[model samples]
Structures are given as structure tokens and as C-alpha cells.
Target: MKRFITGQHVSLWRLTKRVTAQNPMMKYLIKKIPPYPTPVEFWVSNVAHVTDETGFKGILKSEQFRAPKSELSWWDLKIKKEEIRAAEKNYMKRNFSNKAKEPNEQKPFLETFTTSPLFQLKKSRYGNYRFTFPLAELMEWYKEQNCGGKEPVLRVYGTVTYKQQIVYTVLIHSPEDSERFGEYPLLEASEWVRYQDGKIIWKAQAICETHRYQFVSGEVQRLKTHLFYVWDQVSLVFHLPNRTKPCKAVKIPRQRLIEALEACKLDRKIDLLRYKSPKNKEERFFEAKMKVSELKRELEEEVKEEKSEAENDIKMEVDP
Candidate 1:
């Protein structure tokens, strides 16, 4: 009959069997099971933790009740070893094949230069070169040039690698030299090795413009002229006109009046009415009074005309 046991019962059975097997006389009393034991307390603890933390409850369903014992023969071990060896060999072969596709052989700096867009044969006049200098040597040269000051300057570094090994020292140059003569220059210190396959083909130097003084100057001047033009336009738009006196009371449309004010403000021609030295306050007052008097006389004449017209109309009506 197949027997079912609780997890705790399994642990107790395994522990009892282990104790029995340790004694030669009790060994026969304990039967060896094909599948080996489970630790019930461990499972119970894990389950309790998972439940309390609200984590990984699915693991309980998949938990193994017993561990399987390995029953490998000598021949099985030999076959397994052979399989591992084959896997390793295949992995190595694949790695070598990939390396072959992209050969690790480092080409000479000149050969690399020839492949660059800036240094093609057709662009010979455009300055093309290569450099081979270790960092130490490059730093020495930099110090010699007094360019080690604490200013931000462009720097170039390059390396030549073959088979994943750096076979040549890199060269370093100031940004100016790098720009004029391709990044790699022909002129480099003697300590570095030049390589064709691993040889230096050629090196040249050219000047690079670090600061464009003329271009910057022109840009600044252009901006200044633009600002001046804008200021002139604003001045013309917002200028207030000289007011001799608050404008006379007139029933003019608001829009028309605003437009007139804006026009007067923008008008640059000097306003003759705003003479620097008005003859005197008295003169100015007298002139203003005379103007008012003339206006009053005109108004009186207009009233008289209207009155005469009304009188004539009354007479005509009586006669009729």
C-alpha cells in the first residue's frame, strides 16, 4: 500500500533513519528509500514568512517533498566529462571564428589614415598624418611646449590594437595640430613605434583654429547695429509731442485723436511751437489770450448770423 506522510512526519522519519543507520546493529532496522528526505520545519518557516510578508505563495505549491539521489555509474561520469569537453571546444572554436571575421591584426597608423575621410589620397593637401606616442612621452612634449597651464584645451588620444592587445603607443597633439594635420601626425617622438601592419607610415602636422577672432568680431558688430536700429524704432513709436496747452476741447472720435497723438509723437521734425525761450511767461499768456479773443469774436459772429436767420423766418411766417 502507498503511504502518505505529512511534511513533519517525513523529517522525523529521515532523522530516525539517519540515527539508526549510524549504529551497525540498527542499520538493518531502517529501510533506505529511493528518494531522500525533506526538512519539514524549514518548509514551515519559509511558508510562514511568505504568508506574513505577502510574498511568493506560489513557491509553496511547487516545493519538493523529497530530493532525488544520483545513481550515476562510472561510464556515466566519463560520458558527462566528454560532453563538457566538447562544449568547451565548440565554444572556443566559435570564439576563434568570430575573431577571424574581424581580424585583430592592428594595421599601421598610415593605413588607418588612408581609410579616413579627411586623409584620403585625394585630400593630400588637406593635411593628413598619424602619431605614435605613449601618454608619458606625450606629456613630456606637452610640458616642453609650456601648454600644461590650467586652461581647457582640446586633446587627442589614439591607440593601435591587434588581437585585443594594444601593440602601439598612442600619440597626443594639441587641438590646433590635430585640426591642421589629420588627428595622427607624422611628426612624433622617437620612442614610439610606427607600424604599417604594425608600422608607422607617415606623420604630418597642421594648424587648427582654436579661436575664431574675426568671425566673433563680425558677429558682435552685427548685433550692435541691430540693437541700434530697434532702439531708433522704439524711440519714434513712444515719443510724446510738445503740448503748448492741454488740447482744446473738441468732440473728436477717440480713434482719430489717438492716431493724431501717435503721429505727432513719431514726427522727428522739431516742433516750432515749443521754442526753447518763449519770449516770456507774460508774452506767452498774452499770445494765448489774443488767440482766445479771436476765437470768441468768431463765435459771436456765428451767433449773430443764427439769430438773424431766426428773425427772418418769423417775419416770413406772419406775412404768409
Candidate 2:
């Protein structure tokens, strides 16, 4: 009879345990526990590409600024207008000379114009666009403004042509340096193409309004003059037809470019590795708790199961 009672008790306990384990509440509790995070998943969650989310937009927005006109009494709008006229006059002269030249003579003039300080000609088989600026004259203007205590203003006045059609006038200026900063019109460009072969081949062109920016003081502030200096030297070398090797266009001096990058807070460590999510210490702690809580719940459930099994065995023996 005792052996029979032990067998019945064992069968009843097994049935009860199966029913309890299959209960909706038990299943819900089990699902409430999250799975352990793998090391690869954790690492991936922390780092991201520079182009992710607002990455590109954020960088661009940081570089943009529009100062009020009241703040720029120093920059006379008339000067910018005059610079445009000067560039226009030079363009007219070059157009006439270019039309009169034969194919052989044209190459010399084209090469000379590409390096001219008073003018810049970007030519390809597609078409040619000219950008003209008198750096010496602009420097004199800068001195007259007594911008020594202030940042230098850059004004780009040029034109673009495509398929033998005159596209539009290209004008851009540093926003803070303009009289009407928030309201002024300027050309907006994408990445500044690194100068190649003493020429710029335009990938595309558009009629848009935007501004160019520069730092108040640093290598970036003086970058314009430095690039122009290099351009002047390269242009002079190419002017000679008897030149042995082709003059490669260098955008900026190596040392100066390095110094400029170091001086820029954005360009220095921007491309380096950086954390992506959990942007703060508090969030990191929360993630740790999440992982720990999952492990803790699992351990507690395992202990509870072992205790239940042991107690069931003891009760079955005691009942018999």
C-alpha cells in the first residue's frame, strides 16, 4: 500500500508541475526576461559612421552663420560691386583675345590666364568659366578697412559657362562681412574641389544663393592668401612654353595645411572613432542594469526550480 501511495504521489506531482510550467502567467514571466546581449552586439551599439543620422547635416550646420547687417558697418557693399566690375572688364578682354587667336596661339593665352592673379580661367573641352579677383587690390582694400582687429572678408566674383552658353554670374562672400548679412545673396557650393593640374573642372553648376565662411583668426583666416601665393608661382612656371615638365597644381602648402587642420577644432579629431549611442554616463548605467537584471532574474528562476524539485522529492518520500 505504501509503495502504491508513493507511485500515485509521484504521478500527481509530475502532472501538477507540467500544468504549472505551461501556465500563461509562467510563460509571460519567462518572456519578460530579455536575452543576454552578445559582445559583438554591445560593441556595435556603441559606435557609428560619420554619415549616420544627423552627422553630415550637423557638421554643415555648425559651419554656417549669418550675421546681422547692423554688425557689418565695416564692409561696404559698393566695394563688392566694384570687384565684380573689375572681373567683368577682364573677362571681356580675354573673350576678345580668345576669339582672335588661332589654335596654337590660343594655348599660350589660356595657360597665362589660368595663372593670372587678376583673373582665373577654368577650361575644359566642355566649356570655360572665368573667375577673376585682384588679390593685391583686395589686400589694399582690406588694409583700408583696418580689419587688423577683425577677420578678413573674402569676395568671389566670377561667371560660369556650359555648352557655349553663359550660365550666370557667381558671387559669394563671407556672411558676417556683408552689410546685409541675413538678407544678402551668395553662391553656395559643395565640397571645395582640390585644385588639380592648375585647373578646376566643374562637376556641375547651379544658380543658388549661399555664403562662404572662414575663421576669425588662424591658418584658415589666412588660407586665401596662402593658396593664391602658390597659384601665382605655379602660373608663372606654366607661362613658359619651353618648360620641361608640367606644373602640377598644389592647393595649399603642406606645412601650412597641416597647421590649419590642427588649428581647426572640427577637422582635427572629427574622422576618429567616437561613441554612438548612450550619449551620457546615466544611459550607460541604465544599459548595465538592463543586462544585469536579465542575468539576475535567470539565476533566481534556476534556484527556484532546483528548490521546487528537491521539495517535491522529499514530500513524495515523506507521504509514502
Candidate 3:
């Protein structure tokens, strides 16, 4: 994920350099050009062809801001106006169109947007993942969660599922919020979290399916922006598990979504692998307890390794 920038923006030159560095042929081709690459040409030839999530495929990587106003490219101004027009058209369509508008063939221009959990993960033609969530519902949830009286701010965490399903899970609470949440796991994301539009956007570097293990490839924050939900096709999960036969997703009510959000908090304590039903309450509870114990042991061992007198870092190259 670090291959992508942690924040919305990063240097186009450096981003391209990383991929090209890995693929020597691309690097050599790029190096053939002097001083720096022609942004549009490089994007069209190589970046455009990269149909993966890690690459800056749907990103606003074209326009860059620099010292002088003259240094900034016209791309940003033109694209911004186009984006505003797209939004205006969408709003008009929603209000006036008789039928539900068809999904845009072009991916979203997400220069100003952030992560949202209300989306549905769907398989793409290229065996990748693309998702869509309602903007209106998300905004409502955000207000309900953050603006209401004495409501504890919801905390979100990202983790890879046991099957290596790369997903951002809303695990109960943050450590600082223990007074309200009770003592649990750190409840912290791998990196910082940015709460936006009711979703907690995490800048995490995990062992995802696509980008492999990004432990410490580089040491730049601006360049290390592997954000979730910022692009169209996300290839993070190698195997999206089949818990049951797939069914058409029903459009859930926004009110249900708000209720669902509340139920996932530390107060309700759901989806911690500890969720119980009417029939298997005791069995599931015990299973969750055992799993927690096992994870505690793993954590202990990790702490021990960290406390050792002096040890060299052992890097593992476990890629998908």
C-alpha cells in the first residue's frame, strides 16, 4: 500500500520512479528521456496501462502545485471544473431523471473524497474489486455519529482477514477512548486515521494481496500514501471468501446503516469474532475467548522480541 501515497497527493515523478525501478524495462524506457518525464506522455504510455489499484490510475496525479502560481499546471483548473460539472449533472439527474441513472463507465474523480465503509465490494471484469456507496447516506451517518449529544466518537481499524482478505474493519474503540470503550486491544490503526464522511481512512502498510508486504520500502510520508477507497479497482484481497452462495445485494435503508454503525461500537462489541446468535451463544463466545487468548500469546512473543538486548531486523518477503 505504501507504493501509493498515504495522502491524496504525491509527486508524480517519484511514484512512477518506484514502479519503474521495480520493472527495469520501464525504468530504462523512462530514463531515455532527460531531466524529467513528460507527465502526460508518461501517464498515457505506462501509468494509463497499469490497471491495478496501487498505481495512480484514477487519481488526480496530473495537476501539481508548486512555488509560483505559474508553476501549477492548467490540468488542475480544467479537471476541477469538469468535476464540479459532473457533480452538478449527477444532482440534476437524481432529481429529474425518471429512471435510476446508469453507473458511470468512467471511475470517480476522487481528489476531494476519502474512505467510506458504506460501499459494497463487487468483483470487476479483471477479477479485481470495485465498490460504490451512497454519498447522502454516508454524510447522514457522519453527522449522527459525530454531532449528536455526548456520543462517543467511533473508532475504525483496518486489518487483513485470516484468509488475506484486505478489508478495513471497524474494530470497537481507540486506546485513548478506553474510559468509554473499556480496555481492549490498542484499537489503533497501523498508521493514523482520518475521519471523513463517516469513514475512518487509514494510511496502513499491511501484507495485502496486491502490493505484497510494505514493511519499510521507503521513508517518505507524502510518498507513502497507500490509501483505501481512493481508487476504482482495489486488488488488495487475493481471495474474497465465499461464506455463502453469492446473492444480489439489497439496498439497505440509511437508518439501518446508522443503527449498524452504533451496534459495531465498543458498547455493542459486535464483529470481534465474538458475535453470538440465539442458538450458538455459548459456543461462539468460548471460541472467541480462545481466539483472543491465542492472539494475546502472539502479542506477548512479539513484545519479547522487541525487548531483546539487540537484534537485527528480519524482513520477510511474503507477497501475494
Candidate 4:
């Protein structure tokens, strides 16, 4: 295999970096950070190639679940291409994204990045926003239609912002219907919700955004709604079951998608409830006022119960 960085293999690199310091007074077992970031995504057309790679199969594919490896050799060995174009494109897009531009200067910065069925909503003449599907609500609706009352997890997806907030267009699967979804992930409660150890914290919230996309789907897609074109797997920028937001549009790794799909096949008794933040100042004020009132009412009830118990105790002591 060709060395990614030099004639030096990744294992050699790891061996060299195993200990940062060797002095008796200042010895430290420092783990080496990966020299290269995981490829933002495989190239759009390279997804099938990725899936076909035996070493790149199953759960090992997703960047999130990657096992520790020699950073130098990951690209040359597991992923094949140095992923130069994908990296360069991501760099360019990130450097000059619309978010950096002034309001009037923000002209346009999107194209039909993914072959998702949500676009059909945008395709309709007068039912919704004219140019785009905006993916946020469409996914939630897809879960509703396909999984019935059971929770649906987005195994892989792309992302876009709807009205300034980020949204995801994704491949969804449910845990309850294992026959149909047994191959996918059934993310465990502990894995789904992570905590802040001394090192870092992880939090995820997925609020349901209700929409009429299902009604619209009945017309345009009929029964053959797209599951998204498999070729552009890297185009999945943000996964639906993910809380971490991406700044630029990129395809998700196909290997990552498969692991998530396989793992989310079971509910795992995880409460992946998505909470919605208040949209406006008025709603925030009302929510705050209600919370305060509820707290005060509970305090009063507790005080009254305590006083009643004291009085009963005094009566018993005096009578006895």
C-alpha cells in the first residue's frame, strides 16, 4: 500500500508518537491526535466504490465510529482516494459561505445537491415554498408515515437551513419493524445521549417539525418516493438523528450511513425526544412566566402540606 504522508506507514507514526515525554519528573502518556481530519465525505460519485471496498464495509465506515488507526494510512488504505476534490470543495464552500455575507449580499448559495424525494414538495406549483424542499419538516413527516407511532431515526442525511435554522434530509429507519430494519442501528440510550465527562460533553435534541409534505408526497411521489440517489451519499451533510451542525453541505460517508441504519433498527428504549426552542420573544416570555407560576404554585402546596403535618403533630402531642 502507498504511504499517505510519506514512505512511513501509519503504524510507525503511531509508534513514534506513543509517548510525548520520557523524563522521570515529567513523564506523560500523551495519546497522539490524528494528524488529518476524517475526510469530510467521500466524493459524491465515489460512494459505490466506498461500499464495495471490503475494508470500508459495515459500521467501520462512519467517521463517528472509526476505530483508532494510523492517520497517515487511512486515506490510502481504507478510503482509497486522498479525497482531494471533496476536501478542496468543502474548504472553498466553508471559506465563502452565505453566512459570512451581509444580508443584501447573500444572493444564493445552493443547488440541487441531493436526489431526495423532499424536492417534490418544492416541485409542486403552489403548495409550498417555490424553489426548495427545505428538508426539516419533510423528514419528520416521513418518519410519521413510515413508522406509524414508533420513533424513526435518520441513519444518514444531507443538510440545509430553513428560515436560518438548520434542517436535515435523511434516510430514516425504525427499531420496531426489525424485519424491515434489522440491518440498521438500534442506537442504545447511553450511546444516543452522551454526558460531559471531565473531557467533553455531548447533547442531542431533535424537535419534530410538523408539515404537510406527506400530503404533498401522496400526489407527486405516489408510491415511489425517492430514498435519495445512492450515488451521492456524501451529499448527506447533516444526519437527522444528529445534533452537531455542519457549516457546509457535504456528502455523508456511505459506511457511516450503513452502521447508523443497522444500529437504529431497535428502539433500545432510548428517548430520542427532540425538544423545540421557542421561536419568538413573545413565546419565550410566555414560557418563562408559565414556568415561574408553576414553580410558585408547587412551592405553596409544599408549604401547606408541611404546616398541616406540624399542626397534626402538635395536636397529637398535646392530647396524648
Put the candidates in lDDT order, highest first: 4, 3, 2, 1
Each prediction's TM-score versus the true structure: 0.16, 0.17, 0.23, 0.20
lDDT by residue for model 2 (42-137), tens: 000010011222322232334211122222211111112233333323433444444433433332221212222212211111111111223333
Q: Across residues 242-289, which tens digit of lDDT does each residue of candidate 4 receive?
A: 222431112334333332221111112221223234343334334434
Off by over 4 Å in 4: 1-100, 106-142, 156-170, 178-320
The candidate with the higher TM-score, 1 or 3, is 3
**Top model number, TM-score:** 3
lDDT tens readout by residue for model 3, 57-91 = 12213211111212111110011234333543453
Using TM-score as the measure, what is the rank order of every candidate, best first?
3, 4, 2, 1
Per-prediction backbone clash count: 16, 1, 5, 20
**Per-residue alpha-carbon lDDT of model 1 for 1-320, expressed as tens digits?**
11222111112223344433334323322433221111100000000000100111121233211111221100000012232233323323443344222223421111211121121212111111111122233233333442333211221122321111121222323344345436333323322222222122212111010111111211211122111000000000001112324211112232222221100111122122333342543453345345434545665677799999999999999995
* Alpha-carbon RMSD, each predicted model: 46.1, 39.1, 25.2, 24.7
- Against the true structure, whose lDDT is highest? 4
lDDT of 1: 0.23
Q: Which 10-residue window of candidate 2 scores lowest in summed lDDT?
A: 38-47
Of 1 and 4, the candidate ahead on TM-score is: 4
> At residue 259, what lDDT does model 1 achieve?
22
